[model samples]
Target: MRTIAYFLVITLICCLAPSADLSAQLNEPAPIRLRNASFEDIPRNSRAPVGWYNCGFPAETPPDVHPDPMNQFQVGMGPQHGRTYLGMVVRDNDTWESVGQELSEPLVAGQCYDFWINLARSKVYLSQSRVSNKPANYVTPAKLRIHAGYDFCDRQELIGESDMVRNYNWQEYAIKLSPTEDYTHLVFEVFYETPTLIPYNGNLLLDNASTLIPSPCEEVVAVNSPLVNDDQKEPISTDPVPGPVVVTQPTTKSGDPQPDPEPQVQLGQSKQVLAVDAVFEVPDITFVANESELTPESSASLQEIVDFLTIYDNVIIEIGGHASQKATADFANRVSMRRAGSVVEYLRTRGIDPRRMFPKGYGKSKPVCYDESADCKRRNQRVDVKVLKIE
Candidate 1:
């Protein structure tokens, strides 16, 4: 009887142990599903993916899905999780490509979650091909930024940005998000670290983007999917230290003609001007192709110039307008002149004295890039500001 009782007690303990384990597994949070997460459903040549929208201008080049056999840009590591992935370009025209999508569900405020994506840099991204003379210019390397916002195409809150991914191999990047506000949209952007730096042409490849998953367990699941190599392990940092967060003020929607509030300028103060050798070019002041009309997006950058002139009353500047090789030399020269004159007129309206400003058009005489690529042409067609005199 004593032996039988001992056997029964052991069996009961074993049964209870399995039941407890089953209950714990049931409590674990399920993984969130991201639509078109692997970028596999889209057509090969489509500019925009099926579940994503172009965050940039319609005229600008949109982000494309890769495995570009036609352009022969398939030499690098393939998609980290599927047959296709996203490709974006930051062109010398100061225009960068971005794509965004509405999340399956809004991120709950104050909830800690894990997010990740696979990133790569294509060594040979063909921007344009010329049948005669100069050949194509490959895109360079640039940083990739991911953002979260409440509205469509908004980048009000930066989530994470990878260090310039120059390697041709695919790398997994991860970040933790603890949102202060509910966010429904996510954006992928290409930008220079500093706005004052000269714009360059570059390409960023994206894939295996996962949605924010609630993480109660300390262990994070590897981000690799079936398409990735079975032997390859997702890079994970244990007890990683969080970095500083950067948040940007929301920008005015494009095409809104209403100007932003101008800075207060005090008159009669001793004039302070930049050094005579200082030459600063406005990075965001751009125009439509072949047209001198300033884009509405140029308002913020132009405002900065206005504030600078107000402080330096004794300074004089020369605005030089240039054009790409998109048109005949004579036509390019005429349009370039008009472009420079437009800037002068804008400054004049903002209370800058006409005597302190000189506007000149160089046409296509000086080219930033001699190659006949699209990015090269955009770089060549620009307006530069030089400080001529600082009395």
Candidate 2:
């Protein structure tokens, strides 16, 4: 009888333990569904897909519902999920295209969620460039940005974004969206590979968007549906750490009244669809030897950081610096710290919030390679931006 009582108590404890975890889990509302999410629209040019409204700037052209049967601008890609898909562009003139819809339920702040969408690029999105006023291929790859706003195209909070859509065929992007506040509206916009630095010509194709589903804060990325990039990250921001494309104007041979251009405004954002431990190498970011001053040639590369920070407003990052073993530990530590702080300062000049970033120097403590060769030393001397928190 005593043995039976012990087994009963053990079973009760085991069952009760999981229930205790429920307290940490949020009481998320039901899974939200979108109306006509697959973008079932009749083929048309300069118009948004059915059920999704145009969210671009005033007088700016709306996204197109393709494959126009007419094959306007040479965008004839077939839909992977339905009869039609959405096409949008970013132009050198500083304007882009987007669409938005009301959410079935408002996303609660501090709750975690994710959604899936199919994205690709068109090889021959033929259009004229505003800078050249001549026929230019809008082929430079672009990306999809997901924003949460209260009204049409408000873009109040950026919730998710995909890596550059380089592939021509349709590929699914699983984006984790962690909103900083409650939002009743959502917007889908196409942006350049880097959001404001170059505002060049590029296009993005989108279709078959899935509804936002509540997910565990620590839920792992979908194994069967991998992220478009090799890295696995969740959308969280850490405060006090620091960080951080193509646009094409859509117009055909036929003369149409060009839309009023929006003033040049660049948005620096955080990585919302990322895991907290994610580390990214900012390409072409280099500094003078033993000095914290960034090399002049690194301007374009550094601009990429500005664009990323503009969109991810709800997260914080760590600008971690490293040094080779050639220098003594003390020297290396100071060098790395100054370099990391220099990167943070550069972003501050570009108008990023200083509170979102802090610097740390690993010095020679963490080397990618130990050899004394220049190649190995250069490899070890690098900078990494680590996401520390998502607010």
Q: In lDDT terms, which candidate is top? A: 2
Residue-level lDDT for 13 in candidate 1? 91
> For all candidates, what are the clash counts?
0, 41
lDDT for each candidate structure: 0.66, 0.74
lDDT of 1: 0.66
My TM-score estimates for the predictions, one after another, are: 0.45, 0.53
RMSD, candidate 1, Å: 23.2
**lDDT of candidate 1 at residue 388, scale 0 to 100:** 90
Distance from true location, Cα of 154 in model 2, Å: 1.5
Put down candidate 1 lDDT per residue, 232-266, tens digits, no spaces. 52222232222222221223333223333332232
